[model samples]
Structures are given as C-alpha cells and as structure tokens.
Target: MNDERDRLEDLNIEEAVGRSTPPDLAERILAAAGKRELDDAVTPISGRHAVPRTHRPTGRRMTSPIARKNWQGAGVVTAFALLFVVGLIAFILLNDPSAPTEQDTAETQEKTDQDRNQPRQRFETPTKKREPSSPDSNEEQPTQPAPTDEPEPESEPDKPEDVVDQPEPRAPVEEPQPEPRDTVKEPEPEPEQPKEEPVKPEPEQPKGAVEQPKDDDKTEVKPEPKKVAVAYIPEDAWRKYEFGRYSVRRSASDEWNSIHGLEKEMGRIWLYEGWQLKTGTGELYFSNGALLQLDGEVEFHTHTRGLRIELIDDDLYVDNVASSSTVFVTHEGLEVEVGNGAAVIESSSGKLGIFCVDGQVSAGGKLIAAGHKASLSNRGLSSINEVTRRDWSHPLLTGARLRQLGIEDFDPAPLGGMISGKIETRTAEQLGLDDDGHVAVDNGGSASVAFRFDGDHETLRGEKVRVRYRVKGAKKLILQMFCPARNDNFGTDIVPGKEGEWNVLEIALSDLRNRETHKDAPPPGTVLSSFALALTGQDDAQIEVDWVELVREAEFEK
Candidate 1:
C-alpha cells in the first residue's frame, strides 16, 4: 500500500510543477489586470459598456480604452444637462408673476363697466380736530361709559390735596380703522309707455263789453252844447271904502239930503245927476272898478255923462276910469276931458297941475299925450312937458332919472361948521307934487348943506337943471355944483316968491361959473362930482325939495 501511495504523490508533485506557468505568462496576467484598473478609473458610473480599443486597418493606432470610455461618459452627461435646462425654462414660463390669468382679466373688465354706469357720490370732510372730554360735571358728554346704580360724582370740587397726588388722565388711544367709502348708486331704468297722438289747441274768445252795430234806419244821439258867462254893471251903482273917512250927499228937487244913513249900507246906492260926493283924507272905489285916491279935502258932482271934480285942496290920484268921456273941473274952473287912463290933479295956490300917466287927456281943447304933464289955470292950459321918453328916444332927468342918478335915498353928512342938516324921503302926496311920484329932500338950517351924489355926474353935461322946492322962513336958497377933477365950484341963487309952497328954479350949464372970487372956473362941459344946497335963514328955517332933474329943452317939443 505504501508503495502505491508513494507513486501517486510523485504524480501530483509533477502536475503541480506543470501548473506553475512560465515568467512570460505571469507578465501577461499582470498586464491584463492593469488594463482593467485603468478602465475603471475613466468609466462612468452609469454602467455603460466601454468600447474595445483597436488599431486601424491602416497604419493609425487605435484609441486607448480609457480615452474611449471618457468620451462615452462625457456624451451621456451633456445630454442629461441639456434636459435639466429645458425643464427649468418651461417652469419659469408657466409661473410668470406679472402675467394675468384668464379669470383675473375678465373680473377687471367687469369692474370697469360697473364704475362707468354708477353715479358718483360726494362726502364733506370735517376740517377740525376732535376735542377731548371737558372736566365740568354739568356739561353734556360726547361718549358715555356703562351706567351703574350709583350716581356719578359731581367731579369733586378741585381739592388742593388731590391735585398733588393725582396724575392727569390720558386721552384714550384710537386704533387705525379703514375709512368708510362713498358708495355710488346705479340709476334705475325708466319704464316704457305707449305712444299717443298729439292734440291741437283751440282758438281764444275776445273779452270786455261790446257795442252792437246800428241798423240803417236807426238815428244817432248828439251831445248838447255848453253856455258861457257874461259880465254886466248895474245902473244904481255905488261903493264906499271899507276903511277911511268920507261923507256923501244926494240931490233932490231944489233940496239936498244927507246920505249918512246909507253909510252902513253894503248894497249899491243910486247916484243921481247933480249929486255931490265929498271926501276928507280917504279913498273910494266906484262900482265899475274905478279907484279914487283923495288927499286932504276934495268935492265932486256926479254929472249926466261923467264926473266934475272940484279939487278944493290937496291932490287927487284917479285911476281905472270906467267912462272915457268923464270931464273933470279943476279948482281954477278949467275942464279936463280924461279918457281910459290914470290922471294926477293937484290944486294949490290957484294953480292946477295935470299929469297923464297913461292914455290921452284933453284940457282946454288941447291934447296931452301919455307920460306928459300940463299946467292949467283959469286961463286954460299953459306949458306941456313930456315926462318920459318914447321907444329908444333919449330920456330926460325926471324923478325916475334922478333915482337912476343915485339920489332916491340920501345919506346926510355935515359939511364943515357952515352946514348942519338931515335928509328925508317924502311921498308925492306929502310933498304936494305930481309926475313920477315919490321925492326926497334935505330939511335943515345951515349956511351951506352939501349933498354928494352916489354916482358920477358926467351925465349932467350940456343939460338944463330944474329943481322944485318949498322953503319955510328962508330968504334965499342957493345950489352949488362941485367939480372935483378941476377943484372948482359953480353956484346959482334962487329968489323965492312964495313960502311953504313948491317953486321951480332952473339953471343952465351955459350960465355956470365959479362962484368963489379969484378961483379958476371949470369949462362949460366940466362934469360935477357933487351938488350942494345952501339956505340963508334964521334958526327955524327949513326947506323941502320936491324934485331935482336935468332935461333937454328940445325934449319938450311935440
């Protein structure tokens, strides 16, 4: 058995020796293992098979196994990265934040349409800040706290001890809240109605009372005419003054009866022919609107045609004569036929002065025109002088002219010691004068009383000077003309024939010369600055001037 076992062991040892390869075979196994390691270092983890390295059929050498494996792995990774980028781009497009969805766009369009259809509403905003609560107990509170059973304390009267211990209450904090928005209300749609046809307006009727038309056979009514009024004078007419003193007498067959019983009668008294009417310082009006102004004493007889006035004394101013044919008999037995005009007749010292203020007068068969004065006596009419100018004719220095010369109102001033006098304004009746009414004078006693004219006397050149005056208890009256430019004076003396009676004295410029001896006299045409009058008489001497005037002699011619 031992011998057989020995033979087997020898055979195994020989086989083992056979299995132990040569060195070249060992090197070939190591090189194959190295190639696997290099492939693992470059192969991707995706488990792809690595391509085998081979040489080209030509001369080119094949690529390395590791390089081929790296190339395959790189291609696989690039494909995967491209897929990842494409997926990220698709996600961004689907989830864009600024783009609106389909549902959101529809909702925004609907909201805009609603706003356009609705009406806007307005709300007034408050301008003042809200105020905190007041401390007074009686004041109403803006907000009330939850009420309790116990009454609220009356804000305990401010105690000094409590003030230091207590802190001021803080205003409650207001949380932020959304403001209430003004809601717009949509207008309701109007209901539709059926259409109707239009109606036409009717014609209007006229108003007010209407008169019916008359037929052809009807006659029209006519209005009556009116009557006019007529004026007439009674035959038995008489008038007595409501004021003044007078007496009347009636004429009968060879007898005279006193009409004093009829003095109180307001009715007309029958004035018969040959009846006499006497008046003493009074006035009377006839029934025909005639006025008889009598001064002093006057007697008149009612004639058949008119009246025969006996101017016993004083003067008579007769106005508004009813009869143009009335005849007046003066105290000198001269008859004056007066027309429808006013006449002033004065009878003094048996001389009658008749002045016709308006209309014409006939005395002693001579016609005296209006504004003319005529002197009459028992021998009939004497001289007739025109008192006023006609039309544009040059006027003479009459009473009106003297007034124009600033002599109507006299202001008296003493001229040295040689004169002492006063001036007075007298009426025509008081001066017993006629023609252009009122007169003025200087009544005093002095050696010489100077009268200065208020205006310039240049108008007195080449004129005749006439002065009518009455002197009482004076021997002579002298008038002097003073020319201030030449410092010279001219004068003339008057010799009176009657005392206490008006007398006219005239002086011509041709006769004027310097009265003072050894003084140069002014030429004939020299203007006078002032005029003076001198009265030589005793202490009781007084004088009255009726009028002083300058006239042209040719003015008196017919």
Candidate 2:
C-alpha cells in the first residue's frame, strides 16, 4: 500500500514540481536520457536535420537518431496526461452517485415478472488510482480488495484497459447506468422538524408554485370572502321610486295638462313629444327603459324618436344605463353623449356643464371617457377636465375642479322648511357642483332650519348627510330627521363638545335611528325629506354653519 501510494503521488503535477523536481528540469532530464539511449543504439548523421513537420509525411524516417528518439519522451508525457485526466473525471462522476444498472442493482422484488424472478447480485462501483509511466508501460497497480463475502472477479489482470471496459467483472454483459438527465435529483434536506408535531398548512397552492417562507413553522390560511345580500329589483323599477306630478302635451304648440294626482304615485307614465316636468324633483322612465331623474329648475324636453333629451332651460340627470338606445343629453341642441351613458347636467347662468359619472359621454362633438367633466356654452367654447381618483357614488355628487374653489359641493337647493337661514353659492363661470352648493347658515336667534336632498341616491354604499355648525350660548342642539316612509319625525339630541368651534355631524342615511325606539324607522337609504336643526334651550344663541354635504362614499372604500 505504501509503495502504491508513493508511485501515484509522484504523478501529481502540483506535488511533483513543488517537492520532487522542477517542471523544466524534469523535461530536460527526460530529453537527455532519451538522447543518450538513441546515441548508443543508432549513429547520428552530422550537420543533417529532420524534415519539416508542416509538410505531409512521405515515408518512415530511416536516417537520423534525433528523429528516432524525438517521439519517445513526448509519447510518455501524452499517455500520462490522458490516463490521469480520464481517471480523475471517472472518479468525480462515480463519487457524485447515480442510479445503478440492472446488473449492479440487487433489489428484492416479488416474483411477478421474469426479470424479477431472481435478485441480481450487487456490485460496488470500481475506483481507479492508476499511475502509469507511459501508455506502453508493463507495470500496473492492483485494485483494492472487495468485501470478504463477495470475491472479486479476475479479468485481463495484466491490462488496466480490460478492467475499465468490463466494470461488472462477474456479469456476462456490460450495463450502463441510468442517464443523469432522466434521473430525479436527490431531495435536499428540507424540514428537520419532528414528524409527530405536524403543522397546519395554508390552502395548497397549485403544483409548481414557489413555496412561501414559513413563520414560526406555521402556514397562514387565507380567509374566504364574505357574501353580501343584494336587494331584488323588480321588472318595473319605476314603481319603487314614486314619480312626481308631471305635465304632458301631445304637440309642441299644444298646452300641457296635469293628469296624475299630487301625492307620491307609482307606475310608468308615457311621455308625448312635448311632455315636461313641473315643480319639485321628479323621476321619469322612458318607453325604452331609460331612467331620468330631474332636479332643480330643469326644463328638459323629451324626444322619443331617438331617446334624446333636450335641455330647454335648466339642468337634468340622465342615468340611462338600462336604455336600449343611446340617451343623449343635449344642451341648446348640442348633445353630450352618443352611447349608453349615465351623466349629470347642470346649467346656472349661461354656461352648461356635463359630467360623465360613468360610461362615455360626448363634449363638443368629441367623445370623452368616464370620470371626466366637460363644460360648454352656446358660444362654441368648451373645456374638458378629468375627474381622476374619484369613485363618484351618486348623480348629485359634484365638486369644484382644478383648484377653482376650495368648496366641495355646489348644487345646494332649498329643501322646504319655514325658517330664517342663509344659503351661499360657490360656483364661478363653470359648473363643478357636487352637493347642491354649500349652505352658509347664520342664525339671528334660536330658530330651526331644514335642508332637502335634491336627488334620491339609492347606491350600493348609500349616501351620507354632513352638517358642520358652531353655536354660542346654547346648551344642546337637536338634529331632527323627517322620514317620508313613516310620514313622521325622528330626532336625536346632540350635545356640543365645544362652544364656538365648528362641530361636524355626519351620519349615514341608513344608520339614522328613531330616538323613541332606537330602531331604524326609515330602513331605506333614499332620505329625500328635510333635515332640521333646532336650538331650544338658549333664546339668544347664534349658530354659524360652514356647509351641509349629501354625498356617497367611493367604491374602493367599500
């Protein structure tokens, strides 16, 4: 063993040049030894050299000793390099481990098939530590001894090539190992936790998904979504919203007549060519299933030929999403939309404003996408502004644009209440109003004031009534809500925290409860009546209000 290791260590290039001999000196010694042997065997020709190597070979060299001894040392070096490289590569491959061939594997399978009748004998992978002096060297190192139970097979004992070619010496035929690409990779040492304490895992991701990192050896489970109960809408949705008393005319020159009673009535009413809306907020359903809600002092004329609405004098709200034809909202003969669209229109002085709440709308013959506001006048002047990052909830939701005014709502209309209060407007040269406009209220003495909601916003998230007021010399404030469903009043007392500072009172319409029973009396979102605020304790108490906004929350907030 000692002599075999010493001879193999001599072949190592790193250990040889570092300790045994210098690389250049070894080459020179080999050259000199070869020359001396050739000189003793053959005579050298004086002043004569070998033929040029680049030219093709003509015949065997039969003359010079230089040519004869030239290939001997180089042949030894080349053979040594080839053998060393082959053995190193083979050792690396065998150590890496692979699936054994049928001849080497000794798996004990039941006698189900002919091949599984007898288990094959297992053979260890043969290792090579060859240290050859040359390709033609007669000296060869013996292989390591196998286990005592399994005797090693003797095949071509004198030749190393025969031992390499016939890896399984005992077997009749050589068998190749399974290809590395086809074999499954060895599993990595993953979780070392005890199998008895198995952890609950998250919803099993689809196969081939990358595993997420573990937290305290536990996988978090995803929550299922909550289902929301939606109210069933009937085929005749117009019956739900009690339509107001409207005037109808057969022709443009004919006089209009009041056909329906003044109370809140249900059912669809067919409109003629010259049908018009009278006083108060009214809901109109066209023959083509278009729902139009008109508020303020809007004098809109309906044209059933193309489902076009002509705003003759005031403003209108067209949410014709269910309409079969394109519900066009025209101001002064100029249409705003050419497709199925829901939009809000408002006209204050001479300028007209069209806001595309959803779907597409047209402005000055050019189409604009949703969430965009377009302002136009009869003088062929128009400007379009995008209402970005806004999930507008209701048709009444509008505001000042591009820093024109800091006010949020501009569509404030007086909900009927007999009181002394002040109303203010915040619009200038354009129509960007959300709530009917801001109501700047100032009380001269202790008195009650009321506000009305112009449009009935029955949205998914519902509407909110916001009131901001400040009082002096008042002990308690009363917020009374008039519910039309009960035709009665439900109020709650609000104790002001601060005396002179503005106190905000914002509550959802659906959250409004009756003070007597603490139950939601209305049970509906369309709180279209009046909201009254009264100061009863102090006689000389003065109240100052900023604004009262009736708006809906955005979609993303839900």
Q: List per-prediction Cα lDDT, in the order shown.
A: 0.46, 0.45
lDDT of 1 by residue, 294-332 (tens): 665444454445555566677666553322235454575
Best by lDDT: 1
lDDT of 2: 0.45
For candidate 1, list the clashing residue pairs, or say none: none
Clash pairs (backbone) in predicted model 2: 336-362, 398-433, 398-434, 410-436, 410-437, 411-435, 411-436, 411-437, 412-436, 412-437
* RMSD to truth, every model: 61.7, 34.5
lDDT of 1 at 214: 25
* Candidate 1 worst ten-residue window by lDDT: 189-198
* TM-score on alpha carbons, each prediction: 0.25, 0.27
* Superposition TM-score, candidate 1 onto the true structure: 0.25
lDDT of 2 by residue, 314-402 (tens): 65666544234565666655656646566678765666777776566676777766677777777653667776454354334442111
